[model samples]
Target: MSQERRNFDKEFKLMTVELSKSRESIQELAKELGIRAELIYRWRPEYLEKPEGSFTGHGKPRHTPEEAEIARLKKQLRDVEMERDILKKGHQHLLQGRREIYRFIACQSSRFPVDKMCEVLKVSRSGYYSSLKGTVSKRAKENQELLSLIKQEHKKSRQRYGSPRISQALRANQVQVSRPRVARLMKQAQIKARMVKRFRVSTDSK
Candidate 1:
């Protein structure tokens, strides 16, 4: 069976072309919008050279200069609104920590430009890129290894051992770790010890 062709209006095509300008790749945008990348590539030039007359089919009226100006203003307004939203949402992370702010930027990278996020968040672009590169410190590497051992000990105990017991087990194996550190790592990993309920019998006297 032959499928019918789909048609998009001028506004949607123009919006897509504008989005393509901001995105890293038109192919990614097309996949997200469920349209062919070729369509966006084809529309980009026409939209750039003569946006007012680009998508007008037969018998359709061409846009006036005033209308084109209004469309341009609307696009600018949309961009401003998007940046405003990114700032609003990322404000809390700014108060939290630099790493948190970097994480927020990374989470929103696909939606907003990284440079814009860094500017809005008052973070250095080099710091953000450095975070991506993950220059792990010696302490971080040690903690990761400790966390792996914690997980193994946690599982070996069948979730019956808390941080105290885990700490003792590690110490027995010549691992110099404190109970408090074990507890903190366990909490971070969400590896809580399962509690067993006590059994009690009730007796009735007549």
Candidate 2:
């Protein structure tokens, strides 16, 4: 195997071991690996899925008739595992070839007309153009800043600001926005206004 494959295997194994607890996120992992998170996402050249079986109990002897049957079962299991390993290696080879093809197409596209890449890669022209769009537009970023300000106003009022109240607050701050649009964005963001729950109200007393 190449050094790249070796690195991929090590990284994959490390990720798999902590998959259940991978709250650290791939963005964090990319920072550690000194690459973009998108690169990290595209790193699984061979197998993107979790691999199976372990190399434990290789020399341990079977203890009873049941254990002996277990040993036999283990032997069959190893044979099946060997077959799977062969398949994985084949898939890895195919993935490497595909990566090479994509890179060649990208480089060629940079030089020549992109119609060639569209024909070769079999992707739509509109779809390709759409992919070039930046993550967050300036207007969207400005709207987000306004949202932060709106949240601050809502916070000051102890989150009692529903769409109407938030609209009023925004207008008061010279925002000049509509309540319905604010409602839509807030709903899309899942930022519901605070209300006195029975649990909280019942528990509170003088």
Best by lDDT: 1
Clash tally for model 1: 0
Best candidate according to TM-score: 1
Candidate 2 residue runs with Cα over 4 Å from true position: 1-135, 197-206
Global lDDT of each model? Answer: 0.89, 0.59
lDDT of 1 at 94: 82
Model 1 accuracy (lDDT, Cα): 0.89
Clashing pairs in 1: none
Off by over 4 Å in 1: 1-87, 94-99, 107-125, 200-206
- Give lDDT tens digits, candidate 2, residues 9-100: 44454464354246468777666755556644443332234233221133122255886898899999976665454444333333554334
